[model samples]
Target: MTFEQLSDMIAVVENDTFLEAAETLNISQSTLSKKIIKLERELNVKLFDRSKRKASLTEAGRIFYEEACRLNQDYFEMLTRLKPYQGNRRQRLCIGTLPILTQYNLTARLKLFTEQNTWIDFSFEETEEAQLLVGLRQKKYDYIIARENLFSKLGCVSVPLAEDELMAVLPENHRLCSCSSVKLTDLYDEKFILMNAYTSIHQLCIQILKDAGITPEIVRTGRVESIISGVAVGEGISLLAKSNFRIFQAGQVKVVPLDPPTKLSVVLAKLAGTAQTDAMRIFADYMCNGCEV
Candidate 1:
């Protein structure tokens, strides 16, 4: 019925399985299944054969899909032809980002870009890494600024923007605060206050601990601000990027570098095969040229 449902159905047929389609669309399998079911109910005809191991399209589905594909192509072509007629209108560029843009010092660059490019209107949505990918795939965002590890295997074009090291964040009075650096083993038995599981930092923390054969007793998980406040109040220690220390109140927490630094790479990513608009191409070049990390 809708463009999204049509696209989802098309993905299942092209990929030959609901699971593959879900992955390709950056949605859960159950969500994809529900969409297809809802779409079938609307049309009052089964789109896929349930008995097949693969997603086999029914006769009705084949007819619908062929027309859908043609319609989609015509729709895009119409938009392309109309682009030249919209004179002097501000172009819209929607961006998806992680919550740590300020910490990474990328906000200043973005602001400057906006100032110089008066003809482009920018919209930013901050969410978890997982949601960023989903938004990009769903065409909800033109681009996403996230950690490189997230889209490395997802066939996205990534331009590295910045880098920072993960460190130990603790209350000013904590015993380890006096040390220049702390090892992962030193905090093995200590209570940890980490960011939510949906964040890249949370996964990094868990992986580092696991690699070192340590089981962290994580007492709390929350947003960046909540975790920082918890650590300040001595709720528990936490691991965070070094650049993040600038955001917290001075003298409230002590941030010491990890013994062997763990680096985080933040990149500007977009769907690999998407056609680059003039605005997109210019912004990409500007950001890549201006960034040092």
Candidate 2:
């Protein structure tokens, strides 16, 4: 099978809709269908079960699609390595981080590395912890900065950057605002704006509460800003990392440090066996040293 066929199959599996995949590839739906059929015939395996309303990959198809994706990623990395040798002096550093950290001057922090070395180019992505780990393993990102707990099984090296304490965010006039520090016990009955289960921070929060023998009354679940906004509108109070307090405008939300404070450790992670380029080394040093912008 040709790389074109592999790409078409990967697209179909990713979009799960022939028409949508075709649209993304800028090809006609009929052509996309022909490509998939040809690929399946060559492989002697059904790539997708087309009988269903929404196309779904068969078990074998799922495995094949994963390999195809890896092949594509490897091809891109090969091209990237060769491209720089052709006088492309701009070195690219891709970083994946959590949304909360991205909101709190992460770009500005990286600016120090770029400004000092004009030949280096930087790109940043903010995504959930699972996606970040996946990208890290796939070598899509040069490095990642996320909750310290996420890198344990990803076979990456990590360096602790900061410790973020969970704080209770409430309205300025809320009764809880009168307290100097609120404990997990204090929030047991309070309506909480929480993060979704897929987020590492959310899972960490749940484990902390469970360990403390407190079951929170979850009123809503979403991203950090959503939780903070919910608190601002009096929907519910939320527990967030102290580093995230800068995301809210002054006077919009009141952030109270938690009693018996729990902290999420932040770390910078890189692939275990990958050799760091000079630019990568400099960037890592800047982050660890807390280089000023």
Candidate 3:
């Protein structure tokens, strides 16, 4: 009926003597006899034949003994699986970032952390600025990294990672490609490919243009690659983070620094007041060190 009673039954059958079984179980022979009696009464079946001096199993007793052994094994396995969660030794980490980080292969740097910590399962999500903030607030993601100012009103804690300098991607034959650095004012009359206005980078570009006292002719609004491909074809020049330089082919575009330089701070943001788990701390450290560009 109970696990202890089932165990006693097994010991009695295995040892073939009530006194020996009681000694093995560290209980008195009378106590073991009562437990076995209780189990037999609960099942309404005879477990052992007392006609002989040594105990012998009934057909029903053999079946119940096999089943109890299996149940005991399964219970141990379940306990092993549950121990980690019970002891706070296991963790699940969800990291979120903007597309720019993925394009630059930032996740590869976390390889060591993943390999070293076998008990922690990790997943990465790439999202836009607004969606990333929403996920962090909803507790769907543990951390997010994006262009600096994106977390301004998101009520999250932001840590600066690096200063990402904005650069101009110019075609090899473009006139400004010869200049070591291009000023924002020089692009006033130039055709430009811009990211969608809804993006944080696009908003930063708009601010930079405003500061330079010029309005760029918006050729199109789309992703970084699309803009870079347009620039490669001489359709229009575009501004991009220096990290994106690796995505463009060597001959396709020339990366020229901005004159009177403008830069955006790269930041890692997390839900405010969220406990900093070991996995989160390792990831943050990896990002801060691995993001050399």
Structural similarity to truth (TM-score) of each candidate: 0.65, 0.62, 0.64
Put the candidates in lDDT order, highest first.
1, 3, 2
lDDT of 3 by residue, 136-247 (tens): 8899999887877777776778777667788988888988889999988888888889888888878888888988998878889888778888888889888888877666
RMSD of each: 13.4, 15.1, 19.8
Q: Where is the poorest 10-residue window by lDDT in model 1?
A: 77-86
Off by over 4 Å in 1: 1-91
Each candidate structure's count of clashing pairs: 2, 0, 0
For model 3, state the Cα shift of residue 259 in Å. 1.2
Error of 2 at 120 (Å): 3.6
Worst 10 residues of 2 by lDDT: 79-88
lDDT of 1 at 207: 94
What is the descending TM-score order?
A: 1, 3, 2
lDDT of 2 by residue, 1-293 (tens): 77787788888877847899999899999998988888888889998887978878899999999999999878755654465465655677899987755544667677766666665677889887788888988889999988777776768887777777788888877888889998888777778788787877777788888887988778779977677778888898887778775665635678998889887778888989898986687678779887221
